[model samples]
Target: MNIVVCIKQVPDSTQVKVDPKTGTLIRAGVPSILNPYDHYALERALEIKAKTGAKITVLSMGPAQAIAVIRLALALGADRGILLSDRAFAGSDTWATSYALAQAIKKIGPADLIICGQMAIDGDTAQTGPGIAYHLDIPQITFCTEVDSDGTKVLVKKLIDGGHQMMEASLPALITTTMPHDYKAKYPSFLAAFHAQDKQTETWTAADVNADLAKLGLEGSPTRVGRIFPPPAREKGEIYSGSPAELATKIVEILKKENLIK
Candidate 1:
């Protein structure tokens, strides 16, 4: 089986900052790490590979700096990695991003499965994975908590609001995983780290993927950020200090004055 895992490099939440003028993230100079949620998806992919001898390939689209996340995926047991980077791809929203990724997947030829995290921490939209599936016109299962393969078909346990539902899908499908999907990720071995460092990740651009020039970047994105601002600070609470009886009376009086209690 050939599996493709989509991963992204995100700014460490602790170090994230916004550009006041543009209302966009200040990516340059911010410390970046692999999106934590993607680790769950990667771990699931590795588990499947371990069980079925599947070949896992990690794919990412970002600036050249995204190579860091791809290398990290290799260290975690991916068979190979690919980086899709181009100046024109900057400022792409989820729609354009998925379109670009779908094209890249087509360039990779054929695959048995595509896996991704439920959502990116920075964007929190949870749309890219399904959006990719939409562009590719493939069946997609989202918020998958458990996955079992019988060689020809995949059995999945999907998380719902109150519980889970089991479903089966044919091979060559896409899945978006959430936290505690199956197991914790394993640490990278020294050998794997060394190999990852030396591995030459395949790099592709919009042209390499035969993407339409007009629909490959920010211009192709349908949504636009209108404004962004930090939430206002909360107001201070009123203090009620005294004996329990006195406090209760004060609270009742305050509530009555505020018309909260009849």
Candidate 2:
């Protein structure tokens, strides 16, 4: 079986800042980490590989710095890696980004399965994976928390708004994973990391992927960021501890005072 996992390098959100002038992230000097959800997705793929002897290929797109995440994936037992890096890919929105990745996947050859995180923390717009499915004309399942396969069909546990559902799909399908609430990402050991450095990794450009030049970057993006600003700071809240009746009365009075209720 051949499995491909799509991963991303993202700024540590807690330490990231937005540039007000450009409406862009201030990536300068911001430490990057593998997108946490992608970590879980990779772990799941590795587990499957162990059972089926599948070859796992880690695929990602970003600046050269993104190579770090690919190396991490290889160290953690991925068979190899592919990094899609090109100046033409900068500022690509979900649509263009997915198009580029779908093109690369075609070049890499057909995959029995393709996996991706439900969303990237940096963008939080869970559209890329589904967009890739659209571009490739493949069926996909999103928000999957678990997956199992028997080489021809895949079974998955998928999350929904109120609960989750079990689903099955045929081979050559795509799935997007959602990490468990308590999921803790794993790192590679020293020896494993050293060995991973010797593993194969290819860097591809838009032209190499045969991507249309007009749809490779910001110009191809339909969504434009007008501006980005932090939400207004919230004021402290007053806490009242009392019996239910007393609390209810106090809440009513406060709501009436604030004209929130009649």
* Clash totals for all candidate models: 0, 0
Residues forming the 10-long window of minimal summed lDDT in candidate 1: 178-187
Q: TM-score of every model?
A: 0.88, 0.90
Q: Identify the candidate with maximal lDDT.
A: 2
Q: Residue 81 in candidate 1 has what lDDT?
A: 94
Clashing pairs in 1: none
Which candidate achieves the best TM-score against the true structure?
A: 2
Candidate 1 clash total?
0
Give per-residue CA lDDT, model 2, range 1-262, as digits (tens).
9999999999997887888788788888999999998999999999899899999999999999899999999999999899999999998999999999999999889899999999999889999999999999989999999998877988999999999999999989999999889888999999999999899889999988999978878998998878866666699988999999999999999999999999
**What TM-score does prediction 1 earn?**
0.88
lDDT per residue for candidate 1 within 1-262, as digits (tens), equals 8899999999998777888898888889999988877878898888889899988889999999999999999988898899999987887899999999999999887878999999988889999999999999999999998876755777888999999999999987999988873556667989879977876688999899999867767799899988765556689988879999999999999999999999
Which sections of candidate 2 miss by over 4 Å? 234-262
When summed lDDT is taken over every stretch of 10 residues in candidate 2, the lowest stretch is: 224-233
Q: What is the C-alpha local distance difference test score of each model?
A: 0.88, 0.93
